[model samples]
Target: MKNQYQVHCDHIDVALPYARNSGDGALIGSMFGVCANGGANGADDVLVVKGVFTLTKNSAEAWTVGEKVYWDNVAKNVTTTATSNTLIGVAILDAANPSSTGVVRLNGSFS
Candidate 1:
């Protein structure tokens, strides 16, 4: 483990946006990561990345496994549509309906 190059990690905890819940897969910019160790708004908590997270989904449309998912900032839910949406990652599990949670893989890149 000497001089090992690390890639993904969950040790970083940064300030959470105002009123942002500690739910897994909560959209943080283009990436959909959440602070598992729930914290108050504007406080720091454990930020977990690179894992399957159950997140809120837009129930208006059904989703299948491997579908491209986007963060609907307006609705505060994950959607399959990309119109005016921020690409978060792909769905690893199917969300049969809206107002439910689906598992997503965190693979969005930072720009």
Candidate 2:
């Protein structure tokens, strides 16, 4: 397979909530990290690693299946969380040839 550039979302509480609130609505605010501070309170530890998904922008808000997205590996395993809300990408099993933009070149961790 070719090299894929996958973004690693920090093990942050803010990120987890975003993943949870994905299908709730459009990216209204906080285009940045919501989990701040080194010794801050964490949500539940549910992590996720998203990928390129479709976005129904300009016209309306929607979570298409081919636009830029994020992902969380640590959270996935640690929390066994659900990213159905704000995530886009196949699991490691179906992500053989990951897209360049939404690929996680992880060795064996989040394969």
Candidate 3:
């Protein structure tokens, strides 16, 4: 047990984006985690970096299994477009066209 070491912490505190109030979710870099507990204005709140999250999407296009997904910072939704988007992760399940959300298998945390 002495040699045991942990690599990453899934939950951490991150500052909320401008105009994004506490309890709201955000996409920080490649991370698409949520805020919980309590925090406000430049303060660090809980951010979950891994898991299957059901987030809002473009809703105009359908998602296929294993398709690469990206986070649209401006639109604040999951999208298939890579241009000007943050690579969040991959779509684990398929979403029918015109849907509002999709299940994403989030990648593990980084430094």
Candidate 4:
């Protein structure tokens, strides 16, 4: 097909919305993905849009497996709170309060 460029879209190259480190989760205008490399804001970088990853989360909040999670862009971490945040994925494992990380599977698309 003339319109076909590439098939798989599990990853994408985008101008970063903010400075990021490798493995950082980013939400660029409703699209969410994990940074494949670290770069300054506005730099073009590959974002992995699918997979399970251990990401930094709110240490004060606990998470249960299968619970929907959101990206706290201001805090630069994951949270269970839905208010004013972007939904990124679901927790794959339970996380305890004061824990610094949580396992998540990226949804690859917004609800």
Candidate 5:
């Protein structure tokens, strides 16, 4: 049994693709996670791959609980639209139109 599990999968160290702030959502390839700390691009930081978090969302879109949510990497926000976006998780609460945030539960899966 040479192969052994080292750490819990809930969090991981990643080479940031861009400068990020703590609590920000990050998409690396098809994997999505919340930044546990702020860091410059190419810096090593921890990403929480699971758990619920309030994330930035499209200001004009409304969301209901259980609705699928996507990450708009360009805008750096969660969105209801699927096209050209990465599926990160689902809405865990209702988000009003003109709102800037939404509650989501991260799926912690690649795409």
Candidate 6:
């Protein structure tokens, strides 16, 4: 492997082995690059990534947004509703700590 480093992120995705129930309805993460502990041991507290954009403030519940969202699997934190989902304006903010490793697929708002 090359060099891997995680930074502050706003909208990202993570894969954990368990699921979490944080009522904040928002977290933070970094863009996809690569990590050492990047594993596929799906967790339960996961944000349940999918094509659904309807993420709500409810824990483990999916809600809809306008622009973007961030899901931290390891830390089980999340943040939704952004301005732009482009790679240029990628938003990533560091969580209380960090999150697990997973795919960070970007999506767009409906027209």
What's the lDDT for residue 23 in model 5? 97
Weakest 10 consecutive residues, lDDT, candidate 4?
A: 4-13
| Lowest-sum lDDT 10-residue window in model 3 | 16-25
Q: What is the lDDT of candidate 5?
A: 0.91
lDDT of 4 at 57: 97
Q: Rate the local accuracy (lDDT) of all candidates.
A: 0.70, 0.27, 0.74, 0.92, 0.91, 0.30
CA lDDT, candidate 1, residue 86:
82
TM-score of each: 0.76, 0.19, 0.77, 0.94, 0.95, 0.22
Expressed as tens digits, the lDDT of each residue in 39-94 for candidate 1 is 66677766676667888888777888899888787887778889998887789977
Error of 6 at 38 (Å): 21
Which ranges in model 2 have alpha carbons more than 4 Å from their true place?
A: 1-12, 15-21, 24-50, 60-111
How do all the candidates rank in terms of lDDT, highest first? 4, 5, 3, 1, 6, 2
Q: Name the runs in model 3 displaced over 4 angstroms.
A: 1-8, 19-24, 37-43, 109-111
lDDT per residue as tens, model 6, 24-73: 22222433222223333452232322223222221442333232344433
C-alpha RMSD for every candidate: 3.2, 14.3, 3.6, 1.1, 1.2, 12.9
Model 1 accuracy (lDDT, Cα): 0.70
* Candidate 3 residue pairs in backbone clash: none
Candidate 4: residue 74 lDDT (0-100)? 95
TM-score, structure 6 vs. true: 0.22
Worst 10 residues of 2 by lDDT: 100-109
lDDT by residue for model 2 (15-89), tens: 233343332111212222222222213233322223322212221212233333333333321111235332333
TM-score of 1: 0.76
Clash totals in order: 1, 15, 0, 0, 0, 33
